[model samples]
Target: MKTEYDVIVVGAGSAGCAVAYRVARESNLEVLLLEAGSADKNMMMHVPMGFAFLLKPHKNNWSYQTELEPYLNNRVIDLPRGKVLGGCSSINGMVYIRGQKEDFDRWAAEGNKGWAYADVLPYFMRSQHNEAGADAYQGTGGPLWVSEIVDEFPIHQAFIDAAVQAGHSFNAQVNGATQAGVSWFPRTIKKGKRYSSAQAFLGAGRALSNLTVLTHAQVTQVQIEQGVAVAVQAEVKGQSILFSARQEIVLSGGAINTPQLLELSGVGQQARLRALGIQVHKDLPGVGENLQDHWNSYIKQKTQGVKTYYSEGRGLALLRNIARYLLGKKGFLGDSAATIGVFYKALPQASSPDAQIHFAPAASEYDAQGNLRPIDAITISACQLRPSSRGSVHINSVAADAKPSIRLNYLATELDQQVAVAAFKKARKILLQPALQGMLQAELAPGADVQTGEQILEYIKSTGEPVHHLAGTCKMGSDAMAVVDECLRVRGIQRLRIADASIMPSLVSGNTHAACVMIAEKCADFILRSSLIELVSPTRPFGR
Candidate 1:
């Protein structure tokens, strides 16, 4: 059976929620949002410290893995994306950050018109209702709630001070005029609770009559007819169904699924689709080519006397913390896991923002699941800002339920390696600072004897893995290789648009949630204006 709506938003992620919420609240458009996972009913999803718990297979996430990176000895790295109603933001570290200004300015210079920092600032302001109150760049009363550090710890403060002593600036806000500094990170938490996209957008619109949210509804393909998106084919409870988009279709399925869905619906390379036994609809060659993300080489340190979260003796404390969290939203469950974030240029001649540092207070035992294991661990992760390397994602076969092939051509550039090396040395400096020296017992990951640049380069090559900030599969630009235009409309297609991280021409500096929602806010305006123009002229296809 088929159901129709003015707009069908796929993925219900940070961007998808923003798109549906804005369309429902601002415009008279009826919207339908479909999520691949179940409703945000998991208790762990609401507790900030519960991010690690939700990373289990067949839980609140689609636990995907990359096809082995040769540099890391062909180890398949895990990639956990949110499958719940709010998407990854629901399971993210919850740190609120907007990247450096140059990141956006570069997008405008790269044929993406009006996407620079200045042009998009208003939308960013429009979506935030800062708990720290309004600032020059922040909003006073927007849907997405952002607040300064509501809960602070001693270790977190020392990390911030150590960064300052190591020549980094101490700015209260990272989302300000300058981004190259260490600061107490602002988060999407309101009243000491996790404020996910589900809370900000979906929660606000749940009572609205014009909006319908379906969880466990995985969209397998976009039903395109004569080069236009008409409906979406979804699977719910092992049953297949169709939902039509009356006005337009917005693909917010994120970096991986967005491109895969487009490719499955025959909207990518004709040669590739033909090989997969699928008929071609449009030949948009840039479907899933510009994959980008942050990668970090962890530096582990052993600590003494002062009990750390990752120490062997702290297991019971952690259990007590978990119990405290379940009983009342308190303890480690309130932590974002990431206590500190820093953005900086690796070298003076660096063309744009080059590196970012993530400070995890826990030890090497703190795995990708964001859970703490026994050991005193503090991670100093550095990622390349604008790595020259590029990758692609495509369907493994014609079957709609099959997972896509993700090839991340990591370390394909010498510059990417150089920045990573530089960022590591800098990270070492911060850890070795006198303020932190008392706590650290030894450097375990990369020892003090590893001095040469070549040695550090090898260490990075051998140890680095992605920070999981994937983007740019359906990049927005006007070039031949560009998949979507500046306004986010697909090339050679009508009434279809991509409103997610996939449309990012270059990955933003920090975590992508804030920027993704900002993109949706701007796109909502574009879509609304296009609809208004159509009503007046009753002609024109809403494009360049």
Candidate 2:
């Protein structure tokens, strides 16, 4: 087997796939993409409704969990990271949300150049093949295929009406001119199957000879020689292997694994490494410091009349649904959870929308073990977009198999506490609206008895969980805590770059899959450009 390559892309997740494909197709750099998990061949990874299956602990799921958090009554939430070629995109809700323009502008304002809304919009557009077609804001042709919900249920429309009746406006496209109001979410599904990053980018470049993708290879650390990352040490089938990278070693292991890998490589806080009896390569405190996630809880309610996806894929219904999908490629299995989404300012004093609402026709709750408890119910879940609270992800042990310590520290900020109350009140107004009152039965959770602000706050804390949008552990910027520069190169380290959600200075206002893809797109462009510059001036190895 080949032991060396021009470039090594770690973790063949969303960003890794994009970078590998871009380098293989656009540049001649021999690329090796390594995934800790196996290939994206699991049938569940392709099914739109298969998220329910993938979300559970399985072979394709990393099945991570947080340390008992003292904030949420000492509850330990399930953290599922995709251990497959597509990574989280293969297992995510498939919601194609781009967050707000201000979210990116804030990044540029924080000294991260070329990341303003205007600068990053093209990358979003370039990665999209929206069913809505080409426009100023949306894209028509791209690797990732996005489409509007074709079989949106009647309850979804009524929920939108209820949102509008509750004082919010109806936006035809949330990814259009503005990010405010209620609209149908653009999903990462096409032709009745989930379109993950692996299928979108890697699938297209299968014919490329220079690109090699390795699965079931868990990278433990980067082999740094004289302060430069030249190779990666990995475990494949109980065998240790070293793969050399002539150019660079790109880390795209998302947030948790990326920082954990860095810390294991002795590239984190010096004191922490010294305490663990490991030699510190670089005392970069920011390697795993800034951890953040969007916190949310479902407001479950029972419906008296209309039928939600209460009993999907059970008994004869399963066979019928499969047959129906096979015949026409249209069914509930093809759609994503929730019908309509609302981006609104929960607090009037807030600058932009402070919360995002995801409303599904059916209701389900997670058990203490993080398993889904399905029911004949509807859910109006709201998430605080810009959380003031920040947590951290640190390695618990030096062993690569050991799970890292995660502290979400949700609702630690008073602003989030207030925002939770506002979101509940706003959702209450929508539920009580005459438009939805016909079919609405009762609020099952934090029901009619729980009315006061204190009660609502208690309800949110007890039931609230992360929407799986983890980021900022390996942040990018010029600050002292910034682990990587604007160009994504790890500070104080040569020939090493960290992409994926780990580099996000802050969590975007919406789902993170699309943003992760955009980051990879830009990273690939820069990699190719840097290679061209090096080719022009042989002595100039790095970017000029």
Candidate 3:
């Protein structure tokens, strides 16, 4: 069997699949993609509403738990990342959104060359097959499909109407024209099935002879020789196997694992490695710093006779959902729990946007089991966009199998707390409006008498949680603090790159699946361009 290939793409998640698909189809490169979990052949992964099952520490998900957060009063947060072939894309909310143009422009402003909105627009354009057809802002022919929700629920329309009454304008396409107001979100779904990045790219390209995808292969380290990445060491079926990369080793292990993989390969801080008893190969200080994620706070209300998703008994609901989904892909299962979203500037004339609101029609609470607790309720989740605070992820032990320590530092920044308070207050006002007053029966959370700003703030701090948009551990920039350069090459390593959500300089305003896909599209071009350059340049290294 051939042990070496042109590129060894690790973590067959959203980004890794994109990298493999592009390399195999666009170039003569032989791409070997490895995943830590089994194929996304799970029946749940295909069902639009099967996310509930996939939300747990399933075969396709790594049920990661965060270090106790000080702001949440030492509560441990469950961080569920996909371990399957499509990674999180196979298990995410599936809402598609290109982040605000300002977010990308800020990357350029922060010294990340070629990452400005104008420069990266092509990559975003190239990734989508928007149902809205060709426009200056949206693409027509692309690998992934983006469609408008065909069945807009009543609650969704009510939320949009309320936002409009509160001075927010209606936007037909937030990913088009401008990302300045409220709109129905586009999703990475086509024909009512989740169009995971793996399905769009890797699955479609499986017919190609040059691409090979291995599942249940957990990569432990990148094999480096004389400061150059040459292969990867992984545990396959409880036995270690080494697969060589004739040309390059790409780390698409994401924010948490990408840095961990680099550190295990002796490519991180010397003192930390020494403490762990691992021989250090490279003393890179920025491998796992700069972790960032969005935090969510909810406003819940109950409606009498309005029919919440929480009313149905578990067995009956499951059976009905299954039967409906089986007979026709249309039903409650086809809906994103939070199908209606509004991105707005909480404070008019503010320097940057403060809040993002997601209106979920379901009357349920996500408990520790990732199951919806039975109850009659719909929730408005308000998130602080572009948090001013930042956190870090680092190794806790020298053991390669140990989980990395994650400190979210959520709500640590005053601006973040302020935004949370404001957004929660605003949601209350919207609920009280005449448009929604008749539909809402009563305030089910934080109650009506909790009027003071301080009271609302306290409520938010006690109940806030993560939206599952983690990024920036191996940030890309031109600073000494950056783990990778603009082209995504590791600072001190050759023929190695990290192309995943980990490389995002900052988190996007919406769900990150679409943004991660765009990152892969851009990195594919960068890799292809560099490979062509090496093919002709005199500096191309000869086989040793």
Candidate 4:
């Protein structure tokens, strides 16, 4: 293993993969990208329908769960984060969505310059090789491949048609000019296979020769020497090893792990670290604060007329699918879990679409121990897009591998509860549409008994699970609680930066992977700039 690199990117996740890719393509800097899990060579990971493969209690997943949410009648839910090369991108449903323009405009409005939708669109376009062809909104010869659904099932188109009937517009693309409509969700898949960020960046970046990727290497702490990140102590195959970075150590360990790493490295709240008997390097109280996630609940319906994923094609369906995948890469397995979507104002008084909706043709639910159980039905899950609730991630111990306390605190705010309740009402309306009514047999989940608003809220409290988009833990801003600056530099610490969903100042309007890719691409630009920021802190009086 190399002892030193020009840039050390800890966490070969959605952002870290992009960082290494951009850096290697732009500069000759020796970059080291590390991942805690093994390689992304698993065939199950490439199949779009195999999204739940790594999400299970597997080696490729972190398998973390949130504590009992006191506000939600005390329910602990599974939080599966990717540990492989592509990180969550590999395990996720492969939904390729850039949040609404207002999400970025809001960030720029909050003093994060160069983060407006207009400013960041080019980076998104630069990273995308959309199958829809190059246009003002998309690019052609980019790394990440974004395409429409491979096998567009009748249920998908039926759902979209049903949404249009329910007083919504039929949008060809949700990632286009507007985000408030029913549309066919774009996916990070190409040729019927899942194309994660690692496939787009690291897979292509290996040819650059300067970029090095190390799998199964878990970083424990960033060695802060005199308030400057000099190296990192990591565990590799039961051996603790230190790797030095000459320029910076970029933490892309997502929302939960990034903050945990910072605190483990003695760079969080002094009070917490002191109690854990660890020396404090920086007293950044917001290291794990401001945690947020989208609260989504499944509303399923038993359908009779529709042919769902559960139906087998007479005999040898599994064998035929495997053969088809190996030969032409076209089959049911190529289908994304969520091929249809809707964005609308759930609450009567809400402006724009405050809720995001997903339509799954196949009915599936997490069984005990968190395994996906397929059912012969259809499901429409809803999540309030911009929830006002906030939660936290913190550590009370120093063990690097020990799971930290994560509290999503779902529906902690009145607005969130109100919007969520309204969202379910809208979901019921769409399910009763004439198109879906033909296929629908009965309400399977939170069934006909759940009608009243109070009963719906109770049902939500009983069945709501996260869409698994956790973000904003180590927020970026100029506030006292800001863990990172506008440039993503860690507050009061030099030669360190965070480039992941964790650094988002606020939750984006939709799925976070696309936003995360854009963030990492921007981080590469900041690092490559000839003139860096010059900040003077207590320990670094000389310069930044």
Candidate 5:
């Protein structure tokens, strides 16, 4: 491996892949993209419906469980992050949601300049090649292929109809003019295969002479020299190696690892760093603060006459589906996990959709041995689009390989609790609609006995799971707790920036993969533009 490069981007996940790709292509900068996990060469990773097998504690997945959450009856929740090239995008359901426009506006409102809906739309467009064609909201001619699910099931349409019958409008394109109502979800798939960030961006940049992509390289810490990030120390195949960055060092290690890396590098709370016996470099209290994730509560029902994934995903049917997918890239295997989506307001007083429902024509449960077993049921999982509850992630040890303490205080706030309950009730209402009622045999989870709001809240506390749309640990804003500025440059650290979900001032209203790509697009633009300016400046020293 090379000892130096123009730029070193840590964590070859969703944002890291994009940033490295853009920087290498847009500029002549030599870029080093480092991933702590193995290559994305797994056969299942390419299959659209293969994410289910990758969700557990697999080699490609960093299945980190949260510290016992106090708000959720002290239960530890599984927090699976992708340890592969594409990061979570590889293991995710492939749902391509950019979130509500107001989500970005809220960031601008929180003093994060140049992050409004209008300001960031171009970046989203630039990173996406929506196969449905381009319009005011959608974009074409990009690396990331965003298209509708290839194989649409009857149950998906039935769920959509049921949601509409439940008073929600039918929106064909949720990422278009407005993000509201029931709609078919767009996915990051191409030619009936999972098109992860690695496939979208890194695939195009891998052959570039200026770009060096390394797998199984775990970054330990950023070496700050005179308050400027100069290099990163990483363990590559169990060998300690240091790579110096000439221009910039970007951290794209998602919400969890980015903050953990910062804290380990002594860029977090002074007291915490000192307590860990680490020399403080930059005392930024927000390094691991403001952690947020969507908490999902599901309402599952037994299916009577419908053929869900439960039936088709096992036995002879499974073999047939696999053959069909291999032959023509068609069948149940070519579909995303959740095909139908409902973005609606759970609270009547809220403007726009404050909650989201993901309808899957399948249900499964983890056995005592942690094996996933499909059940004869369909599920409609609901989550507060904009959760008010805030949680945190912090390093419990100075060791780089040690897992960090993740406290996802789900339903900690009154508003979050109310929204969770309201969304759950709304999902149940949709499931009970005439269109779905004809197919559903009975409510399997949170049955008729759990009807009252209090009962629903209790059920949620017991069953709520993280949707894995984790963000906001390294927030971007003008506030004191903001770890990055609007340009994504890390506060109190020169020549360092973060381009990942961690920089989100707050969680976006939906799945975060699209938003993370957009952030990386903008981050690359900023780096390239700054380099151009510095190159032409008379007073600036060249190659300092």
Candidate 6:
């Protein structure tokens, strides 16, 4: 393997893969992409429904448990991050949501220049090949394949009709001009296979002569000299190796790992670094602060006569579905976990849709051994789209392999609690609509007895789970606590940039994979533009 490259991208996940692919494909610069996990050769990594089996402790998953959350009954919630070549995009539900446009506009409002919906739309368009065809909002002819669910069941239609009867509008495209109302979710699946970032970006650029990729190579630290990032120290097969970067080093580790790496590299709070017995290189207090994630709550209902995945996932039915998928790339096995989605305003005072719900004609629970077992039920899971609560992630150990401390601090604020209760109530209301009332037998979770707002809040505190859309650890802005500037360059450090969810100043209103890709597209543009300018003026300093 080469020791040096023009650009080095750490963590070959969603953003990292895109950054490396764009730099290698668009320019003549040499690029190296590193991933801590093994290759994406696992069968489960490609099968859409295989994510169910991967939810537990698996080789492709970094199933880190959070520290006991103070607000959620001191419960330790599971935080599943992808450890494979595509990261969470490979193991995710495959649902493709670009979030509300106001989400990006808010970022631009927060002093993050060039991040508004208008400014970032081009990047979003440049990253995906939406099978639905290109419109003013959607794009085509990109690497990532964005497809609509091919097969829709009776239960899906029933749920959508019920939601509309409950006063929600029926939207054909949630990721289009407006993000409000019920719709069938679009997915990152193409021809029955999970189209992950690794497959979309890395696979397309793998044959490029200047591009190199190494899996199972964990980056331990970024070597800094006089505030300039020079190289990265990585552990490959129990051996330490130093890889130099002639131009720039891009950290694309997601929210948790990015902040943890920054802290480990001595770019965090000086006091915290000293307390952990680590020498400080740059005192950036916001390296691991302003953490954010969607706190998800769900309502499950037992189905009376409806056929759900619970029954179809067993015995001869399971074999039939498998055969169907294998033969024609069509069946439950080829579908995303959630086939329908609802975006609505839970609070009347909110400007846009403040809550989002995902509907599936199936339900499951963890057994005593923590294995996910299917149940005979349907589920409506809800989460506040833009939460006000903020938590943090920081390293608790000096070792690179040690898991970092994750505190979601979910429902810490009164507004968050109110939104959670309202979203839950809204979900229940939709389930009770006449269109779905004949299908649902009874409410299984929180029960019919729990009707009051206080009871709903209590139920949420006990059962809320992290949606795993973690972001904002290394926030990008011009504020005091911002870790990166508007250009994605780390503050007080040169030749270093972050191109993942960690750079989000505020979490988007929906699934984060699309936004992470957009961030990477923009990051690559910045780097490539700088390189072009430097080429024109040979005497100019690099990445100025």
Candidate 6 per-residue lDDT, tens place, 388-463, comes to 9899899988999999988878899999999999999998899878898778897899798999998999999998
lDDT of 4 by residue, 272-313 (tens): 999999899999989999999999977988988667776532
Count residue pairs with overlapping backbones in model 3: 1
TM-score, model 1 to reference: 0.93
User: Which is the winner by TM-score between candidate 4 and candidate 5?
Assistant: 5
Candidate 4: residue 57 lDDT (0-100): 86
lDDT of 3 by residue, 153-213 (tens): 5666777788788777888888875776778878887777888988898767978898989
Model 5 per-residue lDDT tens digits across residues 5-95:
9999999889999999888876678889999999899888999878878888989988999888999999999999999999999999999
What candidate 6 gets wrong by more than 4 Å, as runs, is 532-544
lDDT of 3: 0.80
lDDT per residue (tens digit) for residues 118-204 in model 2 = 888988887789887888888866788998898536787788888999989999889877899999888989898999999998888
Total colliding residue pairs, candidate 1: 4
Which parts of model 5 are misplaced by more than 4 Å? 533-544
Model 2 off-target regions past 4 Å? 311-319, 366-371, 532-544
Error of 2 at 424 (Å): 1.8
Q: What are the per-residue Cα lDDT tens digits for candidate 1 across 447-466?
A: 88887888988887776767
Q: Positional deviation of 34 in candidate 1, in angstroms?
A: 1.1
Provide TM-scores for the models: 0.93, 0.96, 0.94, 0.95, 0.97, 0.97
When 2 and 5 are scored with lDDT, the better candidate is 5
Show model 3 residue runs off by greater than 4 Å: 307-322, 366-370, 532-544
TM-score of candidate 4 versus the correct structure, residues matched by position:
0.95
Q: Provide the global lDDT of candidate 2 against the true structure.
A: 0.86
Candidate-wise lDDT, in order: 0.80, 0.86, 0.80, 0.86, 0.89, 0.89
Per-candidate total of colliding backbone pairs: 4, 1, 1, 0, 0, 0
In candidate 4, the residue pairs with backbone N, CA or C atoms under 3 Å apart (3 or more residues apart, or in different chains) clash, namely: none
